[model samples]
Target: MKSTVEHLSPTRVRINVEVPFDELKPDFDRAYKKIAQQVRIPGFRPGKAPARILEARIGRGPVLDEVVNNAIPAKYQEAVVSSEDVKPISQPDIEVTEIADGERLAFTAEVDVRPEIELPELEGLAVEVDETEVTEEQVTEQLDQLRARFGTLSGVERAAQTGDFVQIDLSAAVDGKEIEEATTTGFSYEVGQGGLIDGIDEALEGMSADEEKTFTSKLVAGEYAERDAEITVKVTAVKERHLPDADDEFAQLASEFDTLEELQENLRERLGQSKRMEQATQARDRLLDKLVEGAEVPLPESVVQGEVDNRLHDAVHAFDHDEERFAEFLAAQDKTREQFDTESREEAEKAVRYRLVLDALADREEISVNDQELTERILYQAQQYGMAPEQFVQQIQQAGQIPAIYQDVRRSKALINAVRSVSVTLPGGEAVDLSDLLGPEDDAEADEAPDTVEGEVTGESAESTESAESGADTADSTEGTAADAKA
Candidate 1:
């Protein structure tokens, strides 16, 4: 067998492979064996039929066809490997130019390759991170929220008021035609929560028990629906929130604290932790922006195409396999598949570029993940799926997602380390501790970020965070790419 490769782009290649008849003999033999067991000859049993007899009975064409089918994929892959390029991001477009049952077989595969990157300056990048400090007002606000969580609902004899809970069976109609039906015999709502229709709270504002009234409101526009429908709703019940007595008993019942003051302090600590996390996230993003801005690597087109395919696949799945629905979806987005691909092409390229940067940084730093960290990540993931830890690990391994998960963990650590290596300045010109900016310590104990949605960016700094949120705007921004969902 002989092979040759031609560069089509910085990230694409075309490979031509030629195989002589001698090399095709193994596949030919296997195909003949498979065919001999499936057919019978007049003088011989099915499994006992000779290749020559079978050839005369069924023609050599079918056998040759089978041989080509079984042989091409393996040989093509071997040729590709021999070229020493990274694995193809997608299946290659293959074409056979010559094929003979006992003669030569020739084919060509066109595919994308991982791009070689030249990473930009990674150290001493300029960035600013927000400093997180717990305040008395923040503490008090959190305590109030905790109290609200413990508040009880009680039926009200008088007209309902704001901050009250209401339970009602709601129905709607339009132009004398019943348009919507939503019945919850015990449906509860906080008057100003806007959990229901926009005018619902106003409609219930002055209503007493057993008092019924119908009101009209506009339906909120969505991705597909037009915005002209008016809805009618009838109220059935209203109730007020009754605050629990903020005493020692309440504190003990609500938490592990023995007194109200202790619970308030604990609440303050928790809120501080949350605020710290938000601040950390903002700083991390800012640092990433600086890193990406400084990066000088050329993105691999294969990786970018892979990303585009992923985005496209997600778009396709959202339509639920209904062609009309898919078309309507694209229409609503003002995009055709080709157009969307064209638009996301740059984003896809950036995504792949950032990923390559992160991977390379991980390798350069010799960053390693511990078993405990892996176990923790896996366990947290299991909890999200509501499965046992061991069970989730087994399922992940069985599903072949373990390597992906490991890579995710490694990349996360690498990004953190990358950020850690940088020094950040505050708006007031004070140097911020990179450790404080990376994350809070309790992140290990708290629930991990939801595996489904990407980790949301929280908090904002006076500078850099804005651009970071906009995505990597600078050469130094090294924000990792968002993960792809399972296929």
Candidate 2:
């Protein structure tokens, strides 16, 4: 077998492969044998059919077709391997060129090659982040979160004030024409929560049980059917939050902490830890932004288009399948999908570029994840998902997500390490501890790298291909921790 490659672009190549007659003979013979078994000859038994006799009876076209079909893929692989070009991550476009009796098998394959990036200087990237300390107010906020968790709802006979819980049946109308209405059997609302409209909350104020109130409010256009909606709400009940005393007895009932002081101290420590983590995240992101902005590279149009199409597909599915949910998401963001894509394309590009930059940094610095670290991270992630570590590892493999997680961990470590290498001058002129700035115990984990190439990944293309959902879990865990700390 012989192979030759032609460079089509910086990220693509075309390979032409030819299998000699000697190499093609084995497949041809195998094909003939298979055909013989399937066809019958007049003078021979079914199992004892001769290739020549079968070929004579069935003709050469079928046998040759079978031989070509069987040989193309194998030959193409060999051709790719034998050539001086790197094989593709995706399936190659294969085209058979020649196949004749006692002749060589020939084919061509075109595929995208991994780009060879010339990494820019990365040692002095600038990052601007909020390095504010965890204040008493922040601590109090954390404590409030905990209190909210243990708070109880109680019936009230007074007017519904801001922060008061109210039970009501809500209906919406346009020009006195009822559009929607529903009676919630037992509902609770925190008046200042802004969950219901401003007008509804205002009307509910000073309204007690059995007191009916009606008001009109404007609905944000597009998300809801009406441009501006007129809603009529009837306050059926009034309730207020009853929080337990923050003392030793409450502490004992809520958690392992036996005293309120102990709980507060624990909450303070947790809040401090949380703030440090946030600061570290902010610093890392700022540094990444600077690096991406500084570095210059020609992004493959194919890669960007692929990413955009995939994102668009997900967006379309979200909108079409769950319009209400999608609308709610848009409302929170204060923008529609079209508006978001236009405004956020630079962010998307920055994300792509930063991954590439970090990967290059990892390679330059020789960063890696050892087996033990991989196991520990995987186990930790499994525990987070509420699964046994071993079972979760197996599930990750089955779902083909282990590599993605591994790559993410590697890139994160690389980014942390890069930030650690820099000298940070804070706005207040205080020297920042790199280790603390990167996150707790990040230094120890930064040294670990994957042991095998099976899950080995470099370059941002594959990494970005992963689901953009890790941050959601991080946010949930942070919120939960905050709430637990307050308790």
Residues 1-487, model 1: lDDT tens digits: 9999898876667889999989988887898889988997788876788888899899989998898888888887688667764445445678999985456999998865545555555576656756667788887777667779998777767777888777766655445555444333556677777856768888878777677777656543332232223443444667777777778998998899899989888877787677566655556566555556666666554455556766666656665555676666666567786787677776665655555555566666776666666576677667656888889878766654554455456656666656556666777778766464354532442214522111321111111111111121112212222343110
lDDT of each: 0.62, 0.60
TM-score, cand. 2:
0.70
TM-score of each: 0.74, 0.70
Regions of candidate 2 where Cα sits further than 4 Å from its true position: 24-91, 122-129, 169-184, 194-207, 211-234, 244-263, 321-351, 367-403, 436-487
Q: What is the lDDT of residue 369 in candidate 1?
A: 61
Q: Which candidate's lDDT is highest?
A: 1
For candidate 2, write residues 196-313 as lDDT tens digits: 5757667877788877766656554333432345666667888888877777988887779989878878888887666555566566656666665666644444444444555555
RMSD of each: 7.4, 8.4
